[model samples]
Target: FIVGTITSGYYSINSYDYLHKLWLRQLIITSFHHALGFLPSYNILSSFILRWLGAHIEDNVKLAEFQQILRFPSNLLNIEHGVTTFGRASLTSFTMTKEGLCYVDEIYLGSDTNLGNGCTIMPGTTLPSKIIVGSLTLVTQKYASAQSNCVLLGIPAREMPFVIPDDTSVINDLSSLNSSSIYSLLFVCLSFFISKYLFIALYLSSPVAVALFIHAILFCAIYQYSILITKRRSHFTYSEVITHQQYFLFKLMSEFSTFIGPYLSGTQLLPFLFRMLGAQIGSDVILPDIRCITDPHLVNIGDYVRLNMGAYIQAHTFEQRILKLAPITVNHRSVLMSNTLILPGATLQGQNHILPWTLVMKDDQLPPNTKWSGVPAKQVP
Candidate 1:
C-alpha cells in the first residue's frame, strides 16, 4: 500500500513518468554539492568537480565560502571574470543544488559581483558585473539587464537608500559563513571511534566513544538534511500547493522556517531565509520587521519597497471545500506604515503610502503615489 501510494504521488507530480528518480551522475554530483560545494573559490576540489561536469569556470573567478550554498539544484552557472576591482568578500555566488529531473538552464554571474550573506540569487537570475547586493536581501529579478551599484533590501527587494558596502556591510553574517568538507566530517567521526580501541571490539568497549560517534554523525546528517529540505521547499510543485496532505508537509517546514527566521531580522540574512520558505522577493528592499506570511508564494512585491512594523500580510483564505490563493503586489517605492493589514490580490501601485492602522482588503487596487488610511484604507486628501 505504501509503495503504491508513493508511486502514485510521484506520477501525479510528473505526468510523463512515475519513476524518475535522479540519474546516477545527478545523484553523485548532488551528494557532493551538499557535502562540499561550499568550499572557497578556485580550490582544486571545486575546479575538478566543475570540470568533470563540463563547466567552463574562468581562471579569474573567485568563490568565497558558501557562495553557492543556497542556489537551487537545477540552476547552473556560466562563470566569467569581470570585476572592476576586488574587495573584502571573495565574489561569492552561493548556488545550491537542483530538485527533480527538470533542471533550469545556466545562469551567468559576471565578475566583481559581491553577494552578501543571506542573499538569494534564484535560478534564471543574472546580475551585471560590479553590482553590490546588500546582506539579507532577496533578488528575484536579473540585474544582467542593467549595471548599477544598487543596494536592495526587504522582501520583493527594491533599490533603496544607497550606502557603500565598506560602510554598511560590517555586520556579522547572521548565519555561519564557514562550510565543511565531507571528508573532514567522516574523518572526525572515524578518529573518535578508532582512538578508543585497537580493533572493533576495543572500539565498542568504550560507551563514550560510541556516543560521540553517534552525535557527530547526527550533526552531519542534520546539516545535509537542511540543505536538501531547503532545496525542495523553495522549488514549488503543483501537488504540494494544492493537495491537502502535501500542503501540510509544506506548512510543516514553513513552521520551522518561521522559528529561525526572526533571529535573522534586520540582518543581511532574513530575506534569503524568507525566500526559501516561499516569499517572492526582489532587489534592494528593506524588511526590518516581517509580519505573518501565511502563504509566501502567493505574495508579490516590487522594488524599493519598505514594509513597516505591525503589518499583517496574508495570501490565502479558506472556506468550505476550496482554498483560494492570490498574489499581492506592493509596487515600487512604497511604504506601509505601522499596523497595516494587506489581503490577497491587493495591488498597491508604485510610490504609494499607507498611513498607520490601514486595512487593504482582498482585490483592492490603489493608484500610484497615493496616500490611503482608514478601516478599509480610503484615499486621504
Candidate 2:
C-alpha cells in the first residue's frame, strides 16, 4: 500500500511538471506573436525567440530573416538540427481526425533543401535531403513521413517527373546580404529605443512607465484570456465550405492577425491567417492585400499562384436584402493582376492571367493558360 501511494504521488508530480512547462512555453510564443516587432533587424527577435521555443537552429540558416512572417509557436514545433532553407510556414498541428481536431506537431525541413519565395509548407510534414520546393507551391495534403530528393512545385504540389538540381545557392547567397550592415541597423534602432524611453522615464518621474507597464500587462492578460475562451482546434477541410461556427472563429483570428500584420509583412503569415479563418489557401501561394477578402470562408486558392497588388477577390455579394454565397477557386500558377476584381463563384483555372482593371463576373470560369482583360474580363488574343 505504501509503494502504491508513492507511485501515484510520483505520477501526479510528473504530470504537474509537464503541464506547467507546457503552459510557460505556450505563453512565451503567444506573447511573441502579439508583439509584432518589425524593426529593420527583426531577425534578432526570431533567432532568440526560436531558441527559447526549443528549436534547433543551425548557424547561417537565415531562418531568422523571416521572423517578421514565420512563427514557431511553442506547443506546435519540434525542429531538429541541420536544416537549411529560405521559406516560411503556417506549420502547426500535433494530431488530427476527419471530424476536425488538430493537435500541434513538428514540421521539419531536411538539411540542404530550399523552399523558395512564396512557398508554403503546411503542418504535419517532414521533408528529407536534397530537395527543392518551387515558389508558390501548395502543400495542402499531409505526408505521414519524410520525402527526399524531389522537386515539389505548383498548386496541389505535384512532384516533377525529372530530378531537379540540389539547392547549393541558398548558402552561396549569404555574402550578398551584408550581415554587418544589418547589425548596424539593429544597433541604431536599439539605441534610439533605449534613449527615447529612458528620457521619458526620467522626465516623467517613472510613473508613466509603471502605468504603461501595468497597462501592457493587463492587455496581454485580457488577450490571452479571450483566446482561451474561444479556443479552437486548428484543422482544414478538404472541400466543403466552412460552417458558421468555423466562420466566426476564423474571422476573429483574422482581426487579431491583421492588427499585428502590418508591423511585419504578411507574405509568410496570411496563409495561416486565412486558413485559421476558414479560407482554403494552398501552399507557396502569395496573396496581395487580404483587406479585400470578403467571405473568406468561401475562398480557395491553389499552389504557386500570385495575386498582384490591388486585387479584390470576393466570395459573397448582396443584391438588396438577398444574399448570395459561393466559393472562389483560383487554380495553380494563376495570376490576378493589379486592380482585378473576381466576384463570387469565379473559378480561375491553371495558368490564367487577368489583366489590370479586369472585373470577372459572378460564376465566371476562366480558361487555363489564357490572358484575360477588360471590365467584364474577356480573353485577349
Candidate 3:
C-alpha cells in the first residue's frame, strides 16, 4: 500500500513536467537556503536566549543541530559577556576537498559585533568589539582584531579603515557622508566622461576598434579604481543615462559599461549600482580602477583601497529563492591581496593588510598593519 501511494504521488508530479520541474528546483533551492540560514540563526538565537535570561555563554559554538560534532551531541555555542551576536547569523567551518566536496569544520565567535541574518562566519574566524556586519556575507578566514571598532564582509574578507559613529543609531539615508560630497560628484562625472569619450572613439572607429577601445578603457578604469586615491568609495554611473544615442554606439558603450568594467575590474559592480540608485554614497573617496560584473552604484566600497586580482567583491549573494545583498566597503588604505573574496555589506577598516590567497571570514576585524595568513586567515607576527 505504501509503495502504491508513493507511485501515485510520483506519477502525479510527473504529470506536470515543465512547470512542476521548475517549481521543484525553486523549492529545493529555497529549502537549502533556509537550511543554511538556520546555522547562523540557531547559534545567534542560543546566544540571545542566554543573554535575555541573564546568563553568559562561552565555547562550543555550532550554528545548527543537524551539523555533526564528535565530542558533544548538542553544539555548546556561546557568546561571552559584553559580546553581542545578532540573530539570523551563521558561523561556518566547511572546506572543499580535492574531489570537489565540502566538509564541516568547527567555528568560534569573540567579543562584540553586530551581525545581521544570513551572515556566514567561516571556520577559524574571530570577531572583536565595535563591529557591524550586514546580511548574507561569506567569510572564509581566521580573522582577529584588537581594534575597538571595525566592519567587515566578503568571502575572503578585506578590512575597511573607517567605522560608523557609535552615537549614530541608524543610517536612514545611505547617501549620508562619512567623508565629503564634492569629490563624489567629480569621480562620478569623471567615470561617465571617460565612458563617453570612449563611446565617441568607438563610434568613429570600426567594430573591431570599438572592442579594442573598450578593452583599453576597461583596463584603465580597473587599474585606476583599484589602486588610485579618490574621495568617493565607489564610482558607478549608468551608461543608459550618459548617452541618448539610440544607435549601436550607445548600446555598445552601455554593454561595455555594464558588463566589461565590473567583471574585469575585480570588484563586484551590482552592489555599487544599487547603492548609487538609492543615493547612499555621499563620500568623495574613489577606489582603484577595477572591473566589476555590475555597476558600482549597486555596491558600497569604502574609501581609499586596493582590491587586487581574482578577488570576489560581491555586494550580494543569491541563496535559495531569496536575494540577500549588502553594501561592501574597503576602508581607507586597506590592502586586499590577490584572489581574495570580499562579500556584501562589509567594511574593511583602513591600513589593514590582507595577505594573499587568504580568506576573510565575514565581518571579522584585523588591526591596522597586522600581518595575516592561512586558510581561515590568521594574524602573523
The most accurate candidate by lDDT is 2
The ten-residue window of minimal lDDT in model 1 covers: 1-10
Give each model's whole-structure lDDT. 0.49, 0.53, 0.44
Report the C-alpha lDDT of model 1 over 1-381, residue by residue, as the tens digit.
111111101122253332232233334445667345223332334433454444555543334343242222222555655321111122222223344433233455665555543345554566666565543345663433474556554443466566544432211111321232354334444543443233334336668657445533433343344334324433332223333233223333333334444665655455554565457777776776444455555666777777776665666532111235677888889888876667678998888898876767669999999999865568998
Cα-based TM-score, every candidate = 0.35, 0.40, 0.31
Error of 2 at 202 (Å): 25
- Give the Cα RMSD of candidate 3: 16.6
Q: Model 2 over residues 113-165: C-alpha lDDT tens digits? A: 55543456665567776566654455654643355777675555667665543
Supply the global lDDT for candidate 2. 0.53
Once superposed on the true structure, which residue ranges of model 3 sit more than 4 Å away at CA?
Answer: 1-254, 257-295, 298-304
Arranged by TM-score with the best first, the candidates are: 2, 1, 3
RMSD of 2: 17.7
**Root-mean-square deviation per candidate:** 18.4, 17.7, 16.6
* Highest TM-score scorer: 2
